[model samples]
Target: MQKYSERKNSAIDKTANPESGNVQPKPRRRRTAVNRGLDENGNGKRKPRRQARRSRSGGFKNTFLLTGIEILGLSVAAVCAVIMLLGYSAGRFSGTSFFGHLLPFTAGVLVLIVAAALFLLGWWKLRQWLRRYSEFLTPALSLSLALLTPWLVTHDQFTLAYGNFRTLVGGKEEAGRMTISHQVYAAYRRHDAAQLQKMVNRAQEYRQAIEDAARSFAVDAHLLHGIAATESSFIPRDSHDGGRGLFQITRVPETVIAQARKRLNVEKISLDDPRHNAFVAAATFKHYLAEMKDDLFLGLLAYNIGPANGGLRFIMQQYGATDFTTIQPYLQTLPRDYPIRVLAYSLAFRLWQQEGRLLAYEEGNNAIRIQRIGIPGLRAGL
Candidate 1:
């Protein structure tokens, strides 16, 4: 019986053994919470750690970008606002006396600060409201404000304000410029309207020639017209002073004549021909203008003086004169007021071109308006 029982157990062991030819299959592994990517208690699956960090970092970058854009927009708007408001305030508070100007200016600045703070608060609320509709609203509003500021400055009140601001900040050079400019204004005021009107009418025929020459030499046409008006009154004649044609063609440098010849593409220059006369005049003026370092007043004076007496440079050096102001006393024999008269005439021409009539300086607010229009060849403020 024991041997039979042992034989049955041996038969079962052979069936379970891998070395035996008849083999049984192995059992499958049981599933668990850890293998299924869940906690031991069978909770929700955990996300990848790297993926979670990436999501938070992306959110932070987006928030930082938005904050930077907002700050940039606000700063631009603030800068533009400050420039315009400060310009206006400085204009209003300008006074000759130190304390008189300082006290009022300080008070105005304080008021502006308060006003700006209130404006910023209101803008912040508006920005918040606008952000709900569109994320780009803040930048758009800032761009619009920048564009609007330039247009606002073009208005008469703002124009005056800008001029006052320049005056306040300007140094001795500016003071000298203002003094000379006022002289031109006085000369313009003295001109008879009828005579000036006749001169403008006479210039119509020569306008094409003058403008062509001006373009060829990169000169201001209105300024050339002033030179013509002062020289021949647009009459174009041979003078007793050895001057010929419309510009009172005096002695011009050989280089100027050569440049004029090159520009006209002609073998010979004829002062009788209005075109040739204008080209020569333009070249001559350009030469002197460069020699004088583009100082308009000095250039005009040099043009009027021509190369006579070793030119204006030599004359200035002889008297130890440095600028237009210092050279005036030494010009007893020369036409010291030539530049002023020319500029005055140029201003008249500009006024006629813009307003269709010459503005009388003594007329109500006409002086300011004309000044705002500015002299030709000179840059206008604002």
Candidate 2:
């Protein structure tokens, strides 16, 4: 009994001594309401609440700063894109300029790069928008906007409408002067890029003669040059319609030819000679211009379709019209496109003579040979 009691006391001692290495761990102290801003009543405590409010305020400030920075970046990009696009569309830096070639070339290339970057960014944004929206709505809205873009830009802002995909890539310039040649416009309508190319290329060969004739008649050399281009593309030929030579003299009375010869002080004149042809064409144009009371459109029309289609006077009298626009509707019945064609060619030649190229964008492209001043020895004969 004594031994049994001693053993039990030893076991008790061992249990109480944690150094024996067989002790149970103490209970963990649970965090109370005050530690996490909660009170005994379960309401949020003031100290922790203030700290949380401060944290939220800091987060909001950071977010606002980030948003502002994003907006600023986007605004700068937009401004740059617009400037570049404007420069590109207005042809401010292609071919040649009054400001200087190097300036335009450098500026054009830089603007093109910026415009390209902006276009790429916009394309990416468009893709993102498409992804963010429903499939049906995205395509439908995008298509509608795309279709409307050209129409709105062309009609409202003429100069800024020089995008590659626009209806009028070159813009509606020289509208009033477009009626100077019929054959040129016909070629344009037919999309005869080859013949059109020839017109400019051959201009250099007969340029001197055209200039002299125009000077004699007190006419814009480019205008007369345009007429020759339209009539024959500077190639001497006879048409089945009875048109002949560089000017394609068709129905001029013998008396008028004799009078022209006398006025030019040339005893023997042949339509085959470019110089003579240019003189005759200029004289004819002058006579018709006076006959139609100096109405350029009417004069040009009479030269193209002949005065016999009731003449410009009879047509104007019949329609009670005074201006081209007023008479335009009736003109469709005749060779109205003739004048427009002449004008287009004339305008192109004028641009070439002034800027050393056909268009502001014609440089570096294979569209037309802008630098073809004629064959090296071709000018010798003239």
Candidate 3:
């Protein structure tokens, strides 16, 4: 019995001593509050509140940003569409009388508004369907449509429409401009092609000098060419009218001469030199153009009249003339048709530059095409 008890005690000591060769099972671990997702009170813990809030805020911001971009893009497209439609309608319904003009314009506006609304609704539906393909697809299409409007207005077929619309809204100033433009057309029609061709050929000799002066003074090269053509017919000589050189420059302002001298970097000016003559002429024209508030007709007239008898500005003030039209009656003693002749010649040079030859103003479709090309130093596209 003593041997049995001693053997049992030895076994117990070996099990408790891990260094002994006997294997022992590990103790089972009790669950902690953190692993079980409970607080010290045994309640379920909430997810990190700040992280959840941040995720919701981020989603809301993305939604707002996309909404703003979509609205801006659609507004741009709508404005472009409205301008095109209004311009087209105005051109089609233009008239002088109340019934002839007002009724048709009003009817057209109503019709166009209804049509535009229907079109927008259809487009919105289409956008909804396209959104399934790509979130950007609708916005891209809208922006593309907006960009295309400018090109469309400038297109040959649409230019006339746009011009007519401008005229309709442009009032008396536009009427005067149109009148002067037609006068130019008429003058051009009267030109003998062979003689005009000779003038164009002669212009080639001074073309480089004239172009350089024009560039220096920010004047149109063709316009300078026109002045030369009218003044000396490209002969570059003194005239009986006390005018000298290719431009027939006379009575230029002291400031104009100084500006020309500065541009040429010359201490003295000689009218005999074509380059000097061209530069002086360009500077003089630019000076007059500024004085006349950039009215192409009045500017040309002022240049032609020069500072003689207190210049074109003084003459206008004396006669209470506000525009080229009002000044016409007072210009009988002056070269009233000077600007027209200059522009007619300028148009010829422009034609030569564009078409490689002068177009007959009466030829088939040439009239419309030439008008579209427009006069140099003025707006093009009719």
Please, what is the whole-model Cα lDDT of each candidate in the order they appear?
0.87, 0.62, 0.85
How large an RMSD does model 3 have? 9.6
lDDT of 1 by residue, 34-69 (tens): 888899899968799999999999989876776677
Candidate 3: tens digits of C-alpha lDDT, residues 258-309 = 9989999999999889999999999999999999999888999998888888
What are the RMSD figures for all models against the true structure?
Answer: 8.3, 22.3, 9.6
For model 2, give the RMSD to the true fold: 22.3
Off by over 4 Å in 2: 1-195, 253-259, 360-382
The CA lDDT at 258 in model 2 is: 73
Error of 3 at 242 (Å): 1.1
The whole-model C-alpha lDDT of candidate 3 against the native structure comes to 0.85
lDDT by residue (tens digit), candidate 2, 172-258:
423332232233334443544566566688778888887887787776676687677778878889899888899898876465577
Ordering by lDDT: 1, 3, 2
* TM-score of structure candidate 1: 0.77
Residue 269 lDDT in model 3?
A: 94
